[model samples]
Target chain A: MPTINVQMFEGRTLEQKRAFVKAITEAACTTLGSSPESVDVIITDVKKDNWATGGVLWTDKK
Target chain B: MPTINVQMFEGRTLEQKRAFVKAITEAACTTLGSSPESVDVIITDVKKDNWATGGVLWTDKK
Candidate 1:
């Protein structure tokens, strides 16, 4: 079983978010062939300042 | 809003998992004090082989 949780900045349109989720889930399903139900996908949208990678806040990264 | 995604190998009981979630959520709530609805916590249980770190499968690591 494989589950993917995506955390990103909160600005994308609903369609954009849906497409992203669909693509990711399909990739995981096809690559892993995990049960659909077993694959849990959650998207958490946060303020740009809430996330950091490589010691730099995402808001400041760009 | 702070959401924590926890991915781990499967085996823990419901109670154990609930306790873990509760502890994590409470800590996050206290530290971040985000709205309960905004604080989403998702747990993904995977087979040992499905997860890897540092190019090593979790099943083989332990």
Candidate 2:
């Protein structure tokens, strides 16, 4: 079983998440030889203020 | 660098999250030889409806 956690900005619709998870499941199955049903995708809706890159928060970026 | 994703039920306070991340970062430093700054701890607050075990959704469990 393979568990994947995706961190992205919030505001995605349920339909968008459904499609995203479907694509991830397929990719994991094809590349890792894992069963589609056995793959778990957990999406973390991160706020810009909470995520930092290169020592700078995304909210502070231009 | 080590990135740890923790999946737990929601409703934790800010202090709890702070302690959790601190503990995880320390553990990674001890076992994986990763620096505290390089160990990223991402906590995913999963809803019962979105989590499942043994083919049964957590929301549907007793």
Candidate 3:
């Protein structure tokens, strides 16, 4: 039930995404003690303008 | 890839989730014109205490 969603800055290659999914899935299995099959990792490449933190948009703040 | 993430109040059945995924997938395909296979929807059921909006936690604010 440990469905991990990683929202990160865009411009990553397909290979980089595959690596991140693999690593996060392994970490979930180890830390959360869940089966690899049960874990679903979804990567959402968000544009800087679409994300915000601490009440400031990433693009504007960055 | 218009991956949809629906974050709502938890305690829904598996059937409900399946329905949500199916509905959202179709919507993505229709609106975004993306392939169903390319659409990956991940549901993250966060605790009420874990989420915040307008600088106030959901649980505490609610």
Best-performing candidate as measured by TM-score: 2
Q: What docking tier does model 3 reach?
A: incorrect
Give a tens-digit lDDT track for model 1, residues B1-62.
45556565687568666665565455444433345566566777778878776899878985
B12 in model 1: Cα distance from truth in Å?
Answer: 1.3
Local lDDT at A39 for model 3: 71
Q: Write the per-residue lDDT of candidate 3 for residues A7-58, one digit (tens) a residue.
A: 7798876556556666776777788787766775555568999998998888
| TM-score of model 2 vs. true structure | 0.55
Q: Tens-digit lDDT track for model 2 on B1-62?
A: 78787789888999999998998888889988898889888887786545444333455559
Q: Which candidate model has the greater lDDT, 1 or 3?
A: 3
| TM-score of candidate 1 versus the correct structure, residues matched by position | 0.47
Question: Whose lDDT is greatest here?
Answer: 2
The CA lDDT of each predicted structure is 0.60, 0.75, 0.69
Indicate which candidate wins on DockQ. 2
Positional deviation of residue B56's Cα in model 1 after best superposition, in angstroms:
2.4
Clashing pairs in 3: none
iRMSD, model 3, in Å: 13.2
The residue ranges of model 2 lying beyond 4 angstroms of the native Cα positions read B1-6, B9-44, B48-62
Worst 10 residues of 3 chain A by lDDT: A13-22
Chain A alone, model 1, TM-score? Answer: 0.72
